[model samples]
Target: MKKTMFAVLAGMLAMGAAQAQTLSTNAADTAPHFYMGTGIGVVKDSVSGDRDRTWKIFGGYEFDQNWGLEAGYSHLGKTGFYVPGTTDYTAAHIKSSSVYAAAKYKYALSERTSVYGKLGLSHGEYRYSSSAPGWNFKESNNGVYAAVGVDAKLTERVSLYAEYERNGKRAWNGPENRIFGAGVKFGF
Candidate 1:
């Protein structure tokens, strides 16, 4: 009877330990590491269109089942002529750089794949270049962004992802800029 009781107690202890949860990106080889991405955007007005590209590089820390934190840098720029056959136009070659902190939620579709969404705030500077002589404009602002992404873990420490985000850049003219991008991530 004593031997049987000892065996039952051992089984209970093992079950208790098994029921305890363990979480960490490192625990799953099919976990995300880092990401880099960009977006193609078009800004339009009654007389002109400003087309440009925006990009970002970010890293995430997976603390548990459905939550993470992300931080990254992004930039968007555009330059060209507008209002064809007109000299009285502005050249809004605007470039912006910002750092953002975001909270993420993800759903796993498979051992190697997952889709996630994030929302965050960023502070950045805008450098606006104009075609008019001595007419450069510069300022800074705080903005918010929402993004969606999918990641494929290729290894225990590496993952690749494609993501898109809205970058709000309002030009002096009548055009506004947005951003999108895709890139790889590495985690420790």
Candidate 2:
């Protein structure tokens, strides 16, 4: 009876080990190693009467499930700035591109849905052009970037996310910007 019991216990242990291996494999498969995404949103200058249609394209590498490095280019489009108390106006085409190394903390709401917050240091160039004489500007800046978002998996390799992000202030007295947008990501 003792030998029989030992054999049964060993078999159960073997099965458990195999099951654990399978679970680990599944988790790794779902974890994103590399991803690329694009989003469209509106960007507004908080200190100026400038608002524009914005779009961004980004790609990143996940070191683990909760940490990643991301780089992106953002086109803030044309922003029309009206001189206060005057009918004179100027339009500036703005573009911001950044590279951020971010830490992401996430809480799983379900098997396929999660909420995450990202905090990072962003280094980028801010460029703007205006039709007004001598109004063109280009500068490089580093600042803090943060975002809170929710992600839902649509497939094993594709997911959709909606996020509100503060892209931080640019150097040289550039206006701060924010974006609320949705994006789709493909994982590899």
Candidate 3:
């Protein structure tokens, strides 16, 4: 009986030591790091039912477990409008892009997952050009930008994220561009 009890206690101690080693080796650090990612999404104009492809490339520094800052540029895509009564021919095209920065706040949901929100200011330039000669227009707007997203860690220095972001209006009372996208981030 004494030998049996000693064996059982020894086994339990060994198992506990192994478990602790596993967790320590796999745990993510809260140290600051830099990361970058690119994503593609659709920019939809609600009234026009126009779905256009938009893409962005962004990079940032994560300060700790819950805060970061990032800046990015987006190619907001182009939308071609037909003449008022005709769908067979194109009349004008509007293209836009933006540059912005934001502060990110993250909340960890688990060892490998988190949700984050960002609020920022954006400046966008929109250009309208007509098929007809000498009919071109340009405008720009500065407004509020916001986003919410979930991130899942894939490895020690990699993650995948899906987000819904609003790029705000192109002008006062102009159409707002909303985007839904997913992408991967690499940390360094």
Candidate 4:
């Protein structure tokens, strides 16, 4: 009876060890090492209350499941306006773009879903131009940026996410910009 009991206990231990190993391997397989994504949204200008189409592309490297670093470029779109005292004849536009880097933190809600946030710095360029002479201007600004989003995995290497971001001020004396967008991430 003692030998039979010992044999059963040993078998249980072996099975538990095997299951643990399998779980570990599965976790490693799902952890993203590198990823890239692209998204499109509308940028709301805080100064003018205008909405314009915006788009971004980004790549990231995960240090582990919960922490990573990301970098991206965004075209924040163009806004057109009428030159003062010449509303019918003179039109000018402002175009904005930025490059940014951020540290990301993610929290898992399930095996297939997570929520994440990013905080970083961005360098922005804004160009104001018109057919009318003396209306051309260029400026650059640097400021902090932030974003929050949810990610849902469709497969081991592919996922989708929706995000809201503040792209920062266009210039020292210009407007703040915000975006809401969704995109797909490909992991490698």
Candidate 5:
């Protein structure tokens, strides 16, 4: 009886140590050092006639558990509007594209979830076209951009996220472009 009890106690101690080592190794392996993702969503302009489709591709590097840097390119789709009560019917369309770099901050709510915010500088170009007067205009400008979102880890190397972002204003005093979207991120 003494021999049997001694053997069982030793086995339990060895098992506990092995479990601790595995947990530490898993923690190191699950940290996200780099990640990339692409998202497609609806873009709405305050002055435009309707909401349009928007898409973006982004990549980032996490320097630590709480902070990172990101860069992305986005296409804000075209919006069309018609002038009413006109002798000749005419429509105007506006389209835009942007590139931006931002700093990201994350607040972990649990082991699998976090909330984040971003602020950045954006450079974009807008094109306007009208059929009535045969007018076409193009303009480029730089502006400030911002976003807030949440992320939920789905696996060791993948996460799912949803965000609300303001890419930037089209011009100094022009309309702002906004987007709401969800996407998956792959980490390395």
Candidate 6:
């Protein structure tokens, strides 16, 4: 977690320093400006395919052609983990949530459409303890995500898009969350 934040901050500082020398309000610097957006979303846990909704928020600076930084939180719900033997172990109604920080690079396909790739650290959350009956596990773990999606500029300062995200489980989670969501971002 600390390393991820450090990277983000360092990257942002580098970008800022670089831009300071070339940025201009005129056509010479007609490059893209920084913008931020946030919205709500839903996450579907692999276990039982249950869905937990959450407030999704992300913000970063968009520059030149297509480059930016974003981070957000995703609230997830309980998922069932069914073990085959040992009295058919069941990982209770465990509540889960995720927090992620990513850096994205976009490729513009048109004036309003673009595709992006993002990589970063994923933090997962759960409520559990050894003494708890029918449930014993780590409360959190670091994960990874690979997503592909399209973004459309809704207005000069706003945009909308949907992304399909997949994550891998570090331990046991049937599978990570398979999520699809649409959100709108308004630039400031």
Question: What is the per-residue lDDT of model 4 for residues 15-91, given as tens digits with 9 covering 90 to 100?
Answer: 43444343423465346699999987677665577666788999999988899999999988877667776656798
lDDT of each: 0.57, 0.63, 0.73, 0.75, 0.72, 0.59
Candidate 4 global CA lDDT score: 0.75
Model 1, poorest ten-residue lDDT window?
38-47
- lDDT string for model 3 (38-103, tens) is 987667754376666788999999998899998888888876655455455757777788888999
RMSD of 5: 14.0
lDDT tens per residue, model 6, 1-188: 33543453344334434543553333312366666666554665666665565556667666655676777766555555554444746545556667777778888554445667877778877764333354566566877866666666544466666666654343356324655655777766
| Model 1 CA deviation exceeding 4 Å by range | 1-26, 29-51, 80-92, 131-134, 168-177
Name the weakest run of 10 consecutive residues (lDDT summed) in model 5: 16-25
TM-score of every candidate relative to the true structure: 0.64, 0.68, 0.77, 0.79, 0.75, 0.66
- Per-model root-mean-square deviation over C-alphas: 15.3, 14.3, 13.1, 14.2, 14.0, 11.0
| Tens digit per residue, CA lDDT, model 5, 151-174 | 766565677677778876655322
Clashing pairs in 1: 34-185, 34-186, 36-183, 37-181, 37-182, 38-180, 38-181, 38-182, 39-180, 39-181
TM-score of 5: 0.75
Clashes of 6: 0
Sorted on TM-score, best first, the list reads 4, 3, 5, 2, 6, 1
Off by over 4 Å in 5: 1-25, 28-32, 83-87, 131-134, 171-175
Top model number, lDDT: 4
Which is superior by lDDT, 2 or 4? 4
Best by TM-score: 4
Q: Quickly count the clashes in candidate 2.
A: 0
Clashes of each: 10, 0, 0, 0, 0, 0
Point out the worst 10-residue segment of candidate 2 by lDDT: 16-25
Clashing pairs in 4: none
